[model samples]
Target: MAAGVARSDDLRREPVLPPGFSLVTLRESGDAFGHAQAIAAEAGAATLVWVRRFDIVEFAVVLEPDAILAEARLAHYLAMNALADALAIHSPPERPLLFRWPDALTYDLGLIGGGRLAWPADCPENQVPDWLVFGAMVRATTMSPFQPGQTGVGMAEEGFEEVDAVDLIEAFARHLMLGVSRWQEEGAKPAARRWLDRLEKVTGVRHGIEPNGDLVATSQHGVERKGLVEALAKVDWLDRESGGPKL
Candidate 1:
């Protein structure tokens, strides 16, 4: 990893980025999400902050939404949808991509990574958010440098081949922009449908999103919908201990 860093520094001082997006390259030691959230107010929309590293691909995108916090969170699903779509670009055909609801993403039935949201503490739920930040991270390669066959977290023991970290991030940004455009043109319904399609399909459970930002699900013959917001609140994101995703 240190060698990669030295090579990157010697190669180009500026990071290559897509159109309409500004890049903020952080030192390999910096936290992409925390940094983006701290400066989102000034960074504005589509500002992508990424940490150039060898073992992981960590990045965040800043957004200025027109809706209040309540409804704005639906954008989280859009971010995940974009992520899955982005991975599909490099994955083999029929590689299963699924979302574990509210948060967490998987590839080919293996836990890979997920998206998260952040906003200012003072931001009011009723007032439209000035800026909303969506961030994501994926483990590109295991750090068990000496033992290539050693098992690691989740199903990461089965490594992906021929794919690089930057490819996924770049693909995600492009797909996310497309999702934002789709939401504006058609509405959240289309986005919701796309998100639902990628969920880990469960039998006999009918799922739907309420207008006020709750995900509701019920058994085929059930009488009421189960509110999913409560479940989503307990996500072990930010790994309270390390203040980052529980890798």
Candidate 2:
């Protein structure tokens, strides 16, 4: 999947991205997250890598956080919260938005899709990361040209209508900018709260994010903290057998 720089004689003609940002359009088959990470140091912050696809909104943004990687994991919450807000605006009001901790978004009870994050390999946990890429992909269309069950998974099978991927991406970009701006002005705690509000609010369970990006949940009976960094170490969203999203 090759990538091409968006061509515009005047930089002002670019998309109305966050205050200072640039766009890199990738082929539909390209991996936005992988490409963003590959060019993170050079592209710098606010460089958005996107795929122009009809079926799904696939893209990721590069961020230059001022906080250490340990604390900056909270940035994931910022992105997820922004995404949920954006989805809420464009999708059916009844379509539920819930997270599977660290990273994973579910529509109603069925798994739709979620976001993934990547940073420089050499960047230490205590050091402020030079660049970080938060990528996301949502299944918009069924993509089942023939038999629906044969594909194993399809958005239509999951019962989402009227929502397409391209519009979702545009809305998400706008919301993400707003969410990040809030993060800059306020603290991560408020951002975390906003994210928690969108997630499935489990009764009798209090949720919080640790400094190192781990997920903490306190139950009336006991408190348990799931390691976000560790959970991210494994790829849970994609199906190993089918090589796509799991049903």
lDDT of each: 0.70, 0.70
**How much is the lDDT of residue 209 in candidate 1?**
73
Candidates' TM-scores?
0.82, 0.83
lDDT of 1: 0.70
Candidate 2 C-alpha lDDT tens digits along 1-247: 1011112222223345656778898765777888999999998988988776544567888999999888887888888877776666655457677777667777775566678887777889899999889988676554654364443333544554445544466677788788877888986888777777766778889888766767788997898988877787675875656434565
Model 2's TM-score against the true structure? 0.83
* Separate clash counts for every candidate: 0, 0
Query: Residue 241 lDDT in model 2?
Result: 67
Q: Tell me the spans in candidate 2 whose CA falls farther than 4 Å from its real position.
A: 1-19, 145-163, 240-244
* Structure candidate 1, residue pairs in collision: none
RMSD of 2: 5.7
Any idea what lDDT model 2 has?
0.70
